[model samples]
Target chain A: MTLFFVVTLNGLTLAALYFLAASGFSLIFGLMRTVNMAHGALLLFGGYVGWSVVDATGLWALGVMAGGLAAALAGALVQIGVLGRMQGDELRQTLASIAISIILADLMLWIWGGTTYQVRTPSWLTGGTRIEVLGIGYATVRLYLMVFALSVGVGLWLFIQKTRIGAVIRAGVDDQDMLRALGYPINRIFVLVFAMGGMLAGMAGVIAGSALSIAPGTDLQFLLSSLVVVIVGGMGSVGGAALGALLIGLAEQYGLAYAPTYAAVVTFVIMVFVLAVRPQGLLGRAEA
Target chain B: MGTEALLRLSNINLHYGSSHVLHDVSLELSDRPLGILGRNGVGKTSICNAIFGLEPITSGTIMLGDQDLSKLTPEKRAQAGLGYVPQGRRIFRSLTVEEHLRILERKGGNWTTERVYQTFPRLKERRRNLGDRLSGGEQQMLAISRALLLNPQVLVLDEPTEGLAPAIVTDVVELINQVAQEGTSVLLVEQNLHAALAAVQDVAIIVGGEVVERVTAEALENDPKMQKQHLGLEAAGA
Candidate 1:
């Protein structure tokens, strides 16, 4: 029972990471319908940037800012220089993004080499003050992540519902042609949305790296996990994505606790089951 | 802006690939509804698209009052006093009816969300419903309301009464009449001759992608033979 609680707590932390990473994936997909295969690369690439900042400036806050800004800048440049010109052609966008991911992954390998690196949690987040919650003393970072994740989810919901820019974004997501017809410049909106998504991915990368050791093939793992979250949650639904992450996170925890051998396959099983039952995903509209 | 008429589209030519879809089509109009009538194969929707700058023309220009809209993008043209309600009531399925109105806001002495709701009381009742959740008539009403929020001097609506019930069609015709009364130039395309004659002042008939006949609604009612052959109907049968 104690093991179950601990494992569940750990899973929730992992889910939070997945939620942040996958929401960005959802936003970019929602707007342009372009599959950004380079998303996980942006995460891992952001982690390295954060790592470098911590090494130089020795401030965790500075590292976070640096990582986020770098990711946003890179995302904007990639969309404008590579993907923006590929509008109206879905196949070309997919091929171009996949090609860019391959090149970026290779470049990452060349620069960082095939070595595992641990992100040293800043002193502020390193140790947890003991707390007895139903006869279990878990790390404080787990609770912190949960609160932060919930805050982020709520903030995003409000931002999309309450702001003028948010109205335009939602409109764009529903019908890009109609929004453009209303005198909104869709190309500029595309760049801004993509950049915002990258900033989100970067934040997730920084937190995940600090919580767990970063590895050489972290990009592939992040990519696969993000894909699972996206599929389970529903492609264009932000609220669905968060719920999917939590369910998968909790399920993975239970699998790892009781059936350790089945932990790796838990997400895949849930995704397949959901797909079999409802192809449009948990909350998304059916494709016509 | 010239007071003679709100818009004058002169000698417009549109080609898709090597084939020309519109050949020297010119429409001159002011505050009254100009009904664009044609057979199915004729390019009625293409003309609307061309006027809204959704499709590029091979030659000629669309003048809305004083501004020349040929060089501008669709968005710029929309901002420059030209509004469009596309053939299909292209509402956003995920957004609520009110959200759709809010996103298409423009500054001028024009329609606001409240004013639009006042014009379309049905929209106010279905304000919170998602676009897909609304009925066809409601969707069409929202589309028109959204376009009106742009404060356009000239409004071009393509097939406004297509796929609507007779009663809803009457309501739409009434709305168009009310809009014309507000002094906005209206270009209406309709296949229903009875509805067009009831709702419009001037009418143009398109044949082989060009205006074959231009006349007043009274003239079209008078010449039943031309309506029979060109409009694909027999007036006596009706």
Candidate 2:
């Protein structure tokens, strides 16, 4: 029972990380229909930047903010410089993003080298805390990460549901042409959304580094997980991303605990199952 | 009708790759609502698209009261005081009716959300409903009201009466007339001749992508032979 509880907690923690990564990925896809293959590269770059900021300032929160800002700047540049040029061509945009990912990954490798790095957690979050009711100890950082993810999810939901800017975004998601006809500078909106997505990925990178270790392939791993998560949960839906992340996170942890050899294939299986059962995804609206 | 032109399309030409769509289409919209009547695929919608910069015109100048809109993008054209209620109503499926009204509301604009709601009480009643959830008549009213919130100098409506019940059509005609009377220039594009004639003060008949005739509603109403020659109508019917 204790083992099950610990694994469940681990699953929840991992799910939080996945949600942070996939929510942005799903949002960008929802509004622009751009696949943004470079999302993983952005995450990895953010992790490196966070590590450097933490190394310089010795402030974990500052590092997280700096990392997010760096990623956001990069995301906006990517949209303005590359993606915006091929606005309506999805294939070209996807290809350009893939190329960008390759270049960014190589650039990060050149600068940071092949060394693995971890963002040192603040002293308060360094150790485990006991849950008095269950009499179980869990890592404080992981618990905080779960809470942080929840806060972000709630904040995003409120922003999208209640704010005027959120309404415009929702309207753009529904009909880009109509939104344009209504006198919205859609290109600027696209850049803003991309920057926002990058900011989330960057913060997630910092969080992931603090909770776990980040290496060269960390980007590809998170990217794959995000793809699977969005695919299983539904594309372009925040709620869908959360559900998908939870399912994949639990499945992965349980598989690793119970069947180490086949653990890697578990997430893919869930994605395949979802695709077969519901091609539009669990919460994704069907194309008109 | 006011003699001073509020919107003008001078020597406009549009091409879809190799094939020409609108050829030397010149129009001057004064204070009165002008209707462009034509059969399907006769370049009526193309004219709207050209004005909005949805499709780049081969050559021409579109001026909204001396502001050259030919070079502007669709959004820019919209911001420059042209409100478009596109064909099919194109309501954002994810947005609620209230959101639609709120998204386009400009500060100190002539049309406010309160005014729109007052105008179409049904929209206020369905304020919480997603755009796609509304009935066809309700959607049309929301679309019109959404554009009205922009407080545009000119409102372009494409097929406002299409796919509507006769009773709803009557309501839409009344709404168009009311909108024009409120001081906004209207460019109405429609296939329904009676609805167009009833709503607009003047009518332009487009045949083979060219304006074959431009006459007052009264003149077109009295001349059934002209209607049959240009619009393929057996006769003007009630």
Candidate 3:
């Protein structure tokens, strides 16, 4: 029972990180249909940058902001330089993004020296608190991560539902040309969304890096996990990303506990199962 | 009628990968609604598309008021007081009727969301319904309402009544006439001659992508032979 509670807590915390990384991937892919193969690189890049900042300044929040901003800038450059010119050619976009990921990975190696680095958790989140109800203790940072993920989810949902720009985003997701015709500058919207996605990826990287080791090629794993999350959650949906993260996180935890060797493959199995049953995903609108 | 046309297209030429579609097509819209009449393949919709900056013209100029619109983007053209209801309605399938209006709502316009709801009471009833869930007529209504809420200096509609039933057609035509009467200059492109005649003050007939005839709507209404010559519409009880 204690083992179950501990695993559940760990799974939920991991789910939070997955939600952060996958939400941006899903948003960018769902809105523009651009496969950002470089997303994982961005995540690692953010983590490295965040670690550097915290090492220099000893300020964790500043590290998080710096990481997010760095990734946002990188995302904007990628969109304008590579993805924007592809003109709906998926093959070209995919190839371009993969090239970007490789280049970014090499840059990370050159800068960070191919060594795994962990960002120090803030003083407030360094310890664990015992929960009397569950008869277990969980790291305070893990609780913070879960709360942060929930806040982001709720905040994103509110923005997409209540704000004017959110309306334009939703409208553009349906018919981009019509949104343009309505006098809302869609290119600007696209840039904003891409940047936001990058920021989220970066933010996720910083938070996850503090909790776990971030190193070379770590992005590929995170990217793969995000792919599963999006596929299972439904593409282009905020709610879908959360659900998908939860499912993948729980499945991974269970798999790791029972059959440690095959834990990585479990996410794929879940993805294949979901795809076989509902191709559009759990919350995706049926393609007409 | 005046020296300055509100919306002017001069010697416009459009091409689709070297296939010339619009050839030296010129049009002037003033206070009165101008109905563009043409059969399919005659580039009637192309004219509207060009005016809205949807398709780039190979050569020519489009003037909206004092601004030269040929170089501007579609959104810029819209900001310059141009409203367009493109062919196929092009409604955002996921947005609600209220969201459709709310997304494009601008301040200081006589056309507000409440005003649009009052104009199309049925739209008010389906305010929360997604664009895809509405009937064809209701979709058309939402499209027009969205454009109207922009309070454009000129409204361009391309075949808005194409697939609507007869009863809904009357309602749509009535709404078009009402919009025009409320002092918004209208450019209506239609293949239906009767609706065109009823909705506009002037007629510009295009055949094979060139303006073959330009006359008053009343003149086209009175002359059956001219309508037969250009529109190929047979006379009554022929």
Candidate 4:
């Protein structure tokens, strides 16, 4: 029984991280129709920046903010400097973003070296709290991560569903030309959404890196996990990303507990199964 | 130079890459609705595109009220009080009816959400439905409603009544007349000669990318010989 609770908690924590990373990726791809290969690099870059900031200031919270803001700026720069000039050519966008990822990866290696680094969790989040009902002690930071993910999920849903700009974003995804014709500056909206997506990735990077060591190739791993989440949950939907993350997270945790050697293959198996049955992913519509 | 025409096109020439689409077309619209009629592939729609700045004119001037609109983008033209409902009822399929209206609302406009709902009660009933789920007539209504929300002085409707049921066509024709009666200068393009004759005050016919005939709708409506000569359609209007 205690083992079950532990696995479930682990699953939830992993799911939260996956949701954080995948939500932004799904949103950018869904709205802009651009496959941003640099998303993974952005996550790693954000983690490294957060580590350096904490090393300098000794304040974990400030590191998190700096990481998010820095990633947001980088995201806007990528869109403006590279993707914007591609003029809606998906193939060119993919190639350009892949080139950017390579450049970012090389830059990070030169700046931070190939050695692994992790953030020091602040004192406030380091301890564990006992759950009376489950008769187990859980790390407060992991529990907080779960709560944070849930809150972000709900907050994002509300922002997209209720706000005026949210309506414009939804409309823009369907027909960009129509949105422009309505007199809204679509370029600004694109930049804002791209920045927001990057901020989410950066925040996720900080929280996840604090729990695990981040190294040079860690970007590819997280990017693969996010791709799995997006594929399973359905692209371009906040709710879809959460649900996909939860399913993949549970499968991974359970696999780790039972079939440790095959754990890495479980997510791809599930993605393949889902795709065979439903080509549009779990929650995605057939057409945009 | 005289009183400002609502939408003025002078010596307009356009090309789709190297192929010329419109040649030296000029028009002046004031208070009444103007109808541009032509056979298929005669640049009637291109004229509307020119006025809204959707397709760049190769040479000539497009003036809206007192401002030159030859270089403005589509959105800027829309902000400058030009409304367009392009062909095929180009409604956003992902947005709901209410959302479509909300996205186009301008401050101090005579048209409000409440007024739009009242004007098209069917739209109010389907306010929560996505634009794709609505029937053709409903989509057309939503398109017009979206344009009306901008409170545009000049509204260009490209084939609003096309592919609709005969019954729905009557409803759309009535709606167009109602919009023009409310003092918004309308530029209507229609293949249906009877509907055009019935709804517009003035008519212009284009042949091979130029205006070959410009006359009052009443004059053209009465002249069956002229209609047969230009449109190649026998007297269809009663």
Candidate 5:
């Protein structure tokens, strides 16, 4: 029973990280329809930046913030300097982004080398805390990460649902031409959204580094997980991303714990099932 | 007619690939509403698209007031006081009726969200419903209301009454008049001859992608011979 409880908590923590990574991916896909194949590269870059910041400044929060900002700048540049020119050409955009991801991965490897780097947590988050009710000690950083992810989820939901800019974004999702006809500078909005998606991915990278460790191939791993989560949850939906993450995360952990040999196939099976049943995704609207 | 031209298209020519779509199309809109009347496939919507910069004109210029709008993009043209309610009432399906008004609502503008709701009470009733859920009449009202929220100097409506019932058609014609009376110059494009004649003061007839004639609505109404020759319609009273 104790092992099951611990594993469930572990699944939740992992799900939180996946949510942070996939939310940005989903947002970019929802509005721009760009596959953004380089999302995992951005996450790895952010993680590396966070590690360096923490190594130099010894401030964990500052490292997280710096990592997010760096990734955001890179994301905006990608949109303006490359993706913007290929607007409306999805195949070219996807191919271009894939090339970009490869280049970014190589560049990051050259700068940071092959060594694994773990972001040093603050003293408060360094150890585990005993929960009296659960009668177990859980890693403090992982707990905080789950809470942080929850806060970000709520905040993002509010931004999309309640604010005026959010309303414009929703409208744009419905009809880009009409929104432009209403005098909106859509290109600028596209850049802003890309930056925002990058920020979330970057922050998730730092959190992932603090909780585990980041290396070169970490980018590909997170990228695959993000793709699966968004595909299962529904493209372009934040709620869908969260739900997808939770299901995938829990399934992976449970599979690893009980059926070790089949652990790798668990997430894939869920995705295949979802695609067969609902091609638009669980929460996604059918194509109009 | 003497109130100064608000929107002018001069010698405008457009071609899609090698085929020409509009040829030397010219128009002048003043204080009184101007209606472009044509049969199907006469390139009326193309003119609106050109004015909004959706399609680049092959040659000539579109002028909004004294400012040249030929070089601007669609969004920039809209910013320069050209509000368009496109054909088929292209409302955002994901956006609710209230969201449509809220996003475009400008502070200190003549058309406020409150004013729009008051003007079209049915829209207020359907405020929480998604745009696609509204009836055709309600969708048309929402489309018109959103354009008015821009407080534009000129409002261009393309087939505002298409696919609507007769009673709703009457309401749309009346709404066009009200918009014109509120000091916004109207550019109405329609195939419904009666509705166009009822709503606008001046009319430009298009045939084979060219402006055949520009005449007062009253003159066209009385001259059945010209009506049949151009519009293929009997006299208004007949």
Candidate 6:
């Protein structure tokens, strides 16, 4: 019973991480129709920057803020420098972003070296106390991650539904040409959406690196997990991503607890099954 | 010029790369319903776009109430008293009818949510419906409502009654007339010559982007040869 609680808690933590990463990926793809391969690299880059800052200054929130701001800056630059010019070609965007990912990864290697390094957790989350859930004692930090993730989901839902710019974004995703005809600056909306997505991914990376420890090739791992979440959730869908992350996170935890060997394999199978059955995903709206 | 003419297009030409789409298209308008009629692909829509600066004229100028629109962006032109209801009822699918009205609202105007609802009461009923979910006629009403909220002096509607039910087309014509009655100049572009004749007083026929014939409906009714040569439609106003 205790083991069950532990696995479910682990699953929730994973879901929280997946939610942070996938929401931004889904949003960017939803409106811009651009698959940003550099998303993974940007995330790792954010983690390293945060870790380095915290290493130097010994300040936790400042590190997170600096890391997030830097990643957003990189995202803005990429949109202006590369994706802005490569409009109308999907293959070109994918290839260019992949090249950027490779370049950023190498750049990180030169700056921080190839050795795996652990991000120091803030003193607030340094120790865990007992918590009772379903008649089982569990670690407290993991519980906090679960709560934080749930809050992020709710906050994002409210943000997208309530704000004025959010209304424009929703309209833009439905039909960009129509938005342009209605006198909204569609390109500017795209920039704002992309920047927000990048920032969220950066924040997610920071939390995940602090919690689970970050390393070389961590970008690829984050990318793989996010991709799976997106596939399960459906592309261009935030609600779909959130639900998918939770399901996959729990599934992964149970798989890890029982099978151990089929940890990734179980989630992969579920994703494939969900995709083959409902091409648009469980909670996804139709693309058209 | 203030009270005499609301829209003045002079010697406007448009080209898409090497292909010329509009050639020396010129027209003058007052606060009256003006009809621009031509067969398919005669550059009637292109003329509307040029007048609203959606397409930059390679040559010539468009003056809307003393504001030059030759190089202005589409949104800028919209702000400069040029309201265009583009073809295909380009409504934002995600936005509800209310939200559509909210985005196009301008300050200091007779055009308001109340006025729009007064014009088309059906829209007030479907205020919560998304633009896409509406029927063809409802979409038309929403599109026109959005433009009206801009308080434009000149309203350019491209095929306002296309693919609509006969009854709805009547409603659309009545709405256009209402706007004209409110002292807004209407530029009606249509392939339905019969419907166009009922809606406006003046007609300009463009053949290959050049205004081959510009005349009043009474004069057009008298000239059968002009109709046969340019539009190939029988003059029925007589």
Interface RMSD of each: 1.5, 0.7, 1.1, 1.5, 0.9, 2.4
Best by TM-score, which number?
2
lDDT of 3 by residue, B62-179 (tens): 9988789999878898988999898899998877898899888878889999888888899999999989999999999999989988899899999998999988888888988988
lDDT of 4 by residue, A101-194 (tens): 8999999999999998988888978889899999999998899889989998999988887888888888877777766666677778888888
lDDT of 6 by residue, A191-221 (tens): 7877877787777777777778777788888
TM-score (chain B) for candidate 4 is 0.95
Candidate of highest DockQ: 2
Q: Please give, for residues A131-198, the per-residue lDDT of candidate 3 as tens digits.
A: 99998888888898899999999999898877878878888777776777778877788788889999
TM-score of chain B of 1: 0.94
lDDT of 4 by residue, B113-173 (tens): 9999999999999999998999999999999888889898888988888888988888888
Q: Write the per-residue lDDT of candidate 5 for residues A17-84, one digit (tens) a residue.
A: 99999999999998889999999999999999988999999999999999999989999999999999
- B2-73 in candidate 1: lDDT tens per residue? 338778889999999999999999989887779999888699988987887777899988888788988787
Report the C-alpha displacement of residue B62, candidate 3, in angstroms: 3.1
Query: Could you give candidate 2's per-residue lDDT for residues A53-96 as a string of tens digits?
Result: 99998999999998899999999999999999999899999999
Residues B8-115, model 5: lDDT tens digits: 999999998998999999999998999999888989999988999888899999999999999987889899999999998889887889999999998999999999
Q: Interface RMSD of candidate 5? A: 0.9
Model 1, range A1-288, lDDT digits (tens) per residue?
777778878889988988888888887887788888888888887877887788788887777777777877878888999999987677898788788878887887898787876555677677774656658776665577677778888888787777778777877877776676677788898999889888878777776777775666787777778788888888766897797888788888889888889888988999999899977678766764
Which 10-residue span in candidate 6 chain A carries the lowest summed lDDT? A132-141
Angstrom error of the Cα, residue A231, model 1: value is: 2.4
Model 2 chain A: which ten-residue window has the lowest total lDDT? A279-288
Cα-based lDDT at residue A3, candidate 3? 88
Candidate 3 vs candidate 5, lDDT winner: 5
Which regions in candidate 3 have their CA more than 4 angstroms from the true location? A1-7, A80-95, A259-264, A273-277, B1-4, B11-24, B39-42, B206-215, B219-238
Better DockQ candidate (1, 3): 3
lDDT, candidate 3, at A122: 76
DockQ score of candidate 2? 0.81
Question: Cα RMSDs of all predictions?
Answer: 3.2, 2.2, 3.2, 3.6, 2.8, 4.1
Give lDDT: candidate 6, residue A19: 90
**Ranked by lDDT, top first:** 2, 5, 3, 4, 1, 6
Cα error, residue B87 of model 4, in Å, equals 2.9
